[model samples]
Target: MGNLVGSWRFKEPSTVEECDSTWGSDSESDEPVAEDDSGISDSVSPAESERAPGHSGDTSPQLSDSPESAPKMKRSFYAARDLYKYRHSYPNFKKSRQPNEYRNLRFYLNKIPLVPDGIYIEEILSKWRGDYDKLEHNHTYIQWLFPLREQGLNFYAHELTQDEIKEFQSTREAKRRFLAAYSLMLDFYGIKLLDKSGNVARASNWQERFQHLNESHHNYLRITRILKSLGELGYEAFKAPLVRLFLEESLCHNTLPNMQHSVLEYYVYTIRLPATRRRLLRYARKHYRPAHAFLWGPPLKRRGGGVGPEGGVGAGSSGIRAPAPTPEQQRRGEDSPSSPSASSRIIVSSHNAMMCQDLAGGGHKGYAGLGSSMVGLEGTILMAGAQRDRNEYNEIVPL
Candidate 1:
């Protein structure tokens, strides 16, 4: 797969001449050398050296070209030791090596193509979080996730450890959050984890679950979080329902202003239809009079205010919150009328919503898609236009 080149230093094996010069005695031997005593023997191993621990004997001689021939010089490194070399550049081989001082290192490296299996290798390695226990080491940590292929389903499974499941099973809130998050993950990434039942059941009914949450005043934040994730995943199907939730102030009226604002924001940034924009602006102005306090005021009616249904504005907020969109509403959003003029208007409105963010200047009172008769309602009349400045306030006339 790759080519590397570098010079290496290796120790030379000792021959009879080297041994006689290095280990000879001053006295001559009375006996002559034996005919078969060629002075060649097997090299001692590290284990054998350990057995004779205290002896100051020299280590085995460096491997030589032949058993009978001595080498030119003694070398420090081994002759057959495997080595590693990082090829900084190719073609100009010698100059690109790390350095001569780092030659003949006892390390090994593997070379792989920058692209493998038609995908960039870097992308595959990106999932490796390295190691958690050893922060300083460079060991790659792998999650036990695998792509499951069965029947007609093919999705990744996020495997959890026993300890993780134990902790998760103990906390009720954790289960709810995990289920909500798992619903999002299943919808977006085609990934799922085993539920409490340890079944591979798909979260097919997220809408109903969140709608039940809509009835609860306490779980509104979780519902909003789920909606936010859906919106980010570009699930355009949730637009009308999110808008419905946004207007259901009574459903989340008991929640904190921050939670309500998040819901409002998630829907506003998501639903891009021109009709939805008009509806949102009208509802925000009438019901949420403290526009400046919530950081959103009523958008001014462009050119003409003949956008919504002909009805009274204040009549709707009868302490009864609106419900999620019906099947018909969802169907309409999927197949709505779009004209060039309407698209241009939507673009303009979107630009305005982005720019007209300074709600602190003043509040603009809006009607809740109703006629002048709504202003006369006992519940909404006093609250109507209450956030509007007193100096320029005037009686709202019915159309």
Candidate 2:
């Protein structure tokens, strides 16, 4: 065994005649070297092997000299070795390159099996896409589904084609499931919608099912769809509804007021479409007034005066019973004032004697006498005396 471990020395045949003579023995050797049952010596080298009986020594004329076999054999051997190595390393390689948890979640969500529960679907989709940045962060799964929600809402609202509706329904249903699961996960992680009411207001199905959803959810979905639609339209048509919804939700929930206001500011700053910024500003003014004031202060009130007193304009004082100026007052601004130099004015008078007579059948004849001294005054006058008299008279009058 030791000798076998080292290199072996063999005698070399110097000449073809010497090789043939040494290997040509037909009789078995007395030494009885190891031989197979066939009586052929297994210990003999190729050079020492004997030719078969009656065989010619000269080699047959060469037919083909193709080198393809050797190379093919070598390639096959190498390929098999490489395949074994790849199989051994495959798991580790894949594990090392595996995506993160959120990515994996998205991957699974995108392929979630469909079922009958639309609420479950919506819940899952909302859970994943409901957050401010999650939809963008896990865009791989959420992006494809978001547009579908919008489309579904639009189709449901406008009654689009069946094919279009089906397409949106499929996406919406998938997204819904994803959101539901995601919301559950968030709950498990100790994250929650601002509150139950907020959650209910924002819920996509709230209006359809008359279920309260979180307003935050509503704002999130609304803003996201608006942004997506704006992107689709090359940001040409600015939708105030989205901004308005966001502002309203923010005001209702009082969360991320700055963010909501920022959205409004973005609308005012970036959108160049006519009335787009104004509408957004109006919405922001209505709901995000605090944030707007913080950032740029309240909008400067229009300086020119028209109706009622400079700062005490109101419904009863303006004799209109509405905050907005009445049609007559609007028209009166254009009419020539009694004096050319007098500034345009809005008149707020309690019902005049004629109006009182018409409405009350002259019940309070003395009520009209109160305004007798100021009958020709161009400015508005609140008929406190007339209202008092009417109330007093009404108390005495039979129902």
Q: Choose the strongest candidate by lDDT.
A: 2
Q: How accurate is candidate 1 locally (lDDT)?
A: 0.26
| Global CA lDDT computed for model 2 | 0.30
With a 3 Å backbone cut-off (N, CA, C), the pairs that clash in candidate 1 are 13-62, 311-370, 311-371, 312-370, 312-371, 313-370, 372-398
Per-prediction CA RMSD (Å): 36.8, 43.5
**Residue 324 miss distance in model 2 (angstroms):** 29
Candidate 2 per-residue C-alpha lDDT over 1-399 given as tens digits, one digit per residue, 9 for 90 to 100: 766733454443343222221112312122322212111121222211221111111111111223111110001122122212111211111111122222222322453322222222344444544354453333233333333111222221211122332233345443344345435433322233343222312444324221122323233333333343232222223234434454564454544333443353232332323234444544444443222122211221223332322232221212221134456745664473542222332232333332443343444454433232233432123234444444210011000
Per-residue CA lDDT of model 1 for 49-160, tens digit only, reads 1111110102212222331222111111111010000000011211112222211110000122111122222333333222222211211211111100000011111222
Count clashing residue pairs per candidate: 7, 31
Q: Kindly report which residue stretches of model 1 are placed more than 4 angstroms away from their true locations once superposed.
A: 1-234, 249-252, 291-399
Clashes of 2: 31
